[model samples]
Target: METTIALYSHDSVGLGHARRNRALAYALAEHLPDRLGGSVRGLLIAGHPDAGRDPLPDGWDWLILPGLTRGPGGTVPRRLGGDAEDLRALRAATARAALTALRPDLLIVDRHPFGIDGEFLPALRDLRAQGCAIVLGLREVLDAPEPAALEWERLGGAEHVADHLDAVWVYGDAQVYDPRLTGELPGALAHLATTTGYLGHGRPPAPRGERRPAGDGGPRAPYLLTVLGGGSDGAELARVAAAAEPPAGHHHLLVTGPQMAEEDIAEVRSIARPGTSVVRSAADVPELIAEASAVVSMAGYNTLAELLVTSTPALVVPRTRRRQEQPRRARALAALGAVTTQGIDTLTPAVVTDWWRQAVATRCDRTGIDLGGLAVVPRLAAELLGHGASTGRATTGHAASGRRAAGRRTASRQEVRAVAV
Candidate 1:
């Protein structure tokens, strides 16, 4: 029999969660057949319609919920123009309906555990009743420790996490930067966690038989690229990078993502040096980064993942307006000589050229960082679902959760909380 899977990524913010789930879906489809001795099918459930644009496994599809945008206390309807509570209920119903029918053998949830407003609670209960293996996938950097604690507390803390999830996959290499050591991930959930390294490397482009994803096809080689991951909060970084001069002999192309305001994008284009290109997006960022002479980008998880796998020299200007996650990550990689860091406040075009000149001259070395997550995750999923064994590092085992497997719990006790952090 073939294994079935479903992934849920809240879409109130940028497409990072959805994109990460899509990448994992492709990786699982490519690798799981051998372990299962058959095939795999998947469904990616997301809040933004843009989630459907990305390619998936041969038989997999997408379920995009009502769009949402961050508001005062939590997420609000992006365009529905209705009450926030009503939209949350609608999204929850849609997800529950889809999963109740799909009955996936495994459910991999990215970031948000209970979904927005506890949307996944009913679906999780439904899947749990059917013995679906539930796993929470988290990016390596989850902001500084203090705020992370309060945020996790809002989500019902470690006890709540344990009550719902069977395992936790931290998508990063602890050797490069460990969240546990800094209390970003609490000790209570440590026993059920697994470090899956970065998911940016080894990600195959456009699933088989699918057309290539939409991008600008990127500029020619020996050129520098500047990109803002989501562009929602990247106006400052976009301006900085747009103002910076490309290396002496190379061209500079600034890609302002779609989420950025139109005025912001226009401003970036206006100030861009003559002969330079400023667009909204690219079809293949990893491919573009591989061919760049050097890259100037904000230090987001997805951006860092793309940087880590290749030998490209990048100058990361972490956004520290709200959280210290990006800055912390940049500093850690800088410590290992993997990449260089610059705070957005003090960064300037002249400083950019100085670093770009030297960085491209000597490409970065990421020899020690783990880049095998695309291969390890399938094995971990198979093992978690009782099909095979883990092929990667188990930061800690699920021995303590043996009791969890013996019982099923509903997430009713935990009131739905805000997911804006």
Candidate 2:
């Protein structure tokens, strides 16, 4: 018989979680049929008010929940306060209603093991009673160890995952780092863990006739592409990048993520230099990265993965106010010489410009860091559906060839582990 998979992604704050889940769903749909003996049906249970605004792949079904939101000026709505008790109640009610309706064979949750408000537990508990296979998918980094430990404990994160989840699928290479590096994993989770390489991003082919506009081709221009993952905390960064004066013949492409306010967008637009192109989000990000001389960005995992794929020289200024995860990721990637890191507090137009100038002149081989994310999706789907490890060999043929061409840079397993943690 065919299997039904329901994915629960609580993307209450930014576009990263939802975008990642959607990419995984698409990959599962594309590969499950050939890997599994039977067909697979998929559904996305998104708990974000803005979920609809995100573009969905064709042939996917979605159910929206009453997701919470942070108010203007990055404040949580006063009416809701930050009380865990009240939030959990609301999340529980929503999850109960959705699960009762879907009755999925497999439930894959993106982060938040206990749900955004602790509401997911009841639904998850009920689903477990009914014999559902549960999996928890975590991104590589979850912020510096101390705070993460406290937060996870207070939120009952470890207990919840151990008691109810069937497996834990960490997206990155576990041989490189363990979850304990970021925070303490409840002892209960040790046996249930599995590493699936990095759950890399998927790459759809460039749309037809989508070449760079006439007169826009040739000897890589001295330009930088500046991006904020969701544009939630990027107004200042965009302004700084826009105001900088580059060397003669230098230019920039500033992509404001979709979440930026209209005023912020206008501000970026007004300050753009003659050679700068300030655009809203575009589907052709990979193409832009491939063509750019260098990239300036916030350190969201998806964006970092894409930058790695292109091996584009980069300057990463991570967002640090609301969430501290980006800064940690930035530090690690910087350690590997994959990109240069600038903390939000010290980022200035002059500093940004100088970094761009230096990055353009640097000769770093970024191929080592590009994890070949797009190729991992099909392989993950095959594994999820009981097929052996056929996906890796198929998708990474080119990457393997490239690695051979570049000559391997061998790091001890211990070094790789230290980097991952």
Candidate 3:
């Protein structure tokens, strides 16, 4: 018997969701066979075209949707020359058709449950009727409580999402950051919530092509590294970090993410000092993160996950743009001493230089946080798929008091606990 899984990422913003799903695909491929007594094959249903750039598991492939770009108010079509509604219908139909043909046994949704503008709702409903075990994969930190709640309301409340999702897998250390405790996750979601730990301490997906190392395709030993995730709104940070000087005898490598504008890339490249390196993207970012003497980066979830899993000192400059997600995340990790943080608005070359001087003097201590999300997810997938309702309803537990309305599926939710290191 063989199992098929479909990983979906709305990707309205950057490649964070796509990268995370890629990592999960790597994890699932590595661990699922041993648990399920068979091989695994999957598709990465990503919104961004570039999501397919990364290498996938042997039997896995990419299904890129018409991309959605984030803006001041909300998301819009990335490139397709049509109105939002037209694109939504097209994407919805495409996703529905693909999932119906695949008939995957398990489906994992990254972050958004219904996807951008409910593009995923039709497919999710279609798959449920086909008996697919669906899980919602959430990052450790959403926005601050109020905004997150409003956003959740916008994305359909717990009951609406739960109708389609079998489980909610949180990809963060509970001890480090619990959305439930912080009200980022409403009480209605408690019965469905399971912390998968941070997804950092796991086998990394192979780069689709050769990774561009800092210099000469090797570790720039003792070099100070700065990474801007996706580079959509990272121009200011890149400019500031590029102007800063590293500690004595240390060079700096600033990676302006692939999504960054060409002009911004050029500007950063033009201003780069002799000892500083500026590149649009790098291969095997995790490899670079592991080898850095100390690091500076944006507080994007994937980047932060990379930073937290290592002992290399890090300084996070959170994005101060529309959403408070980045700022909230940087502050949480900063509170844990996992990484130092600075407001992008207040950031300056003097601050970067000063922070780097002290940061390199000592390595970070991240032993207390849970980092085993990758290993745990396969178990959850297997358990759910194995016990899947013939009717497609999940056996996931209900909230205390069993407040579920009549006709709703309810079962005891099993919580996955993390032992502190």
Candidate 4:
């Protein structure tokens, strides 16, 4: 019988989850042929606002769900022009139909265990009842230890993993940030976890013929690239960089991701100096990374992974106001000599230009880090389905009440599965 895999990506804030899952699905499609020696199938359940943009792979297809957005408060459905209740019902029904149609032998869910708004629970329950092997995939850093634990407990995330998951794959190296230690992952679930190293931005997708570069009507020239993921809260960073004085002969490409407001994009464009261009999106990031002399970006998991794989020397300005995930990841990458880090509190045009020069001059060595996760993740998936090592026991348990034995609410969340040495 052919093995079928279902991947669910519940993306809210940015394109990270969607992009990562897309890469995983692509890799599986490419590899399952050699591993299984026959036929394999894949289904992707995605909700990225940009889901319609990217090219799809062969032997795999995606179901686009109603989009959602997240804020300091929580998540709310997006793109429905009618009543919120009606949209929610439509979203629920869509999720059910997609899962039932796929009826996969193995289910791999990104991030949230119960999924955003618990929309995945019904399908998860259905799959669980059929004895389908399920896996929860996590990035290297989620947030600082304390708040991450609190958020997980509050959302009943850890309990869900313990109860319903067959395995937990952390797409990172433990030497960087082990989830068990920093994130305070519960021991029971921790036993089922595996660190699959970060996934690489494999060969850039071939552009449809006649594609021009960042500038008007020509191939894009080599330039310094700046990507402020999703661009929702990166106006200040974009504004400052666009206005910065660049080294002579250097051109700039500022990609203010899809979520950036139009007003903010206009503002950045107004201040953009000569030889600098502003774009709302990029379909082929790996190609852009290759064309870039250097990169400046936030320390999001997907972006950092790309930087590491491309060996692009980057100057990272991590976001630290409402969340600490980026800052922590930036510090770790800096310590490993992968990328340079700068604090937003001390940012200035002069400071940015100096770092830009440094990045342009330096060539990063990626020997110390792992970029084999593009392949590792698929192997892990195969293993979960009884093809490799048997996945550890993952019997379900009662949902956590989001509290310790005490009645008090806990504070903070952590991303490390084990303490880094």
Off by over 4 Å in 1: 206-217, 391-395, 399-421
Evaluate all candidate structures by whole-model CA lDDT and list the values in order. Answer: 0.80, 0.66, 0.80, 0.73
Model 2 — which ten-residue stretch has the worst lDDT?
Answer: 405-414
What are the models' TM-scores? 0.91, 0.79, 0.89, 0.87
Q: Write the per-residue lDDT of candidate 2 for residues 261-340, one digit (tens) a residue.
A: 89998998898767777776755666777677788888887787677767678888888886677887787778877788
lDDT of 1 by residue, 173-274 (tens): 888888878888898766678888888677766444433224444465578888789888888888877777766677777878778999998898888875
**Poorest 10 consecutive residues by lDDT, candidate 4:** 405-414
CA lDDT, candidate 1, residue 248? 66
* Candidate 4 segments whose C-alpha is farther than 4 A from its true place: 71-73, 81-86, 201-206, 210-222, 389-421
lDDT of 1 at 168: 86
Residues 201-298 of candidate 4 have per-residue lDDT tens digits of 46336458624444444324557888888788888889988987766778888888878999999999999988788888766666677668888888
The RMSD (Cα, Å) of candidate 1 is 5.7
Off by over 4 Å in 3: 71-74, 214-219, 387-421
Q: Over the full model, what C-alpha lDDT does candidate 4 score relative to the true structure?
A: 0.73
Per-candidate alpha-carbon RMSD to the true structure: 5.7, 10.3, 7.0, 9.1
The candidate scoring highest on TM-score is 1
Instruction: Write out the backbone clash pairs for model 3.
Output: 211-283, 212-283, 397-411, 397-413
Question: What clash pairs does model 2 have?
Answer: 88-117, 92-119, 176-417, 177-421
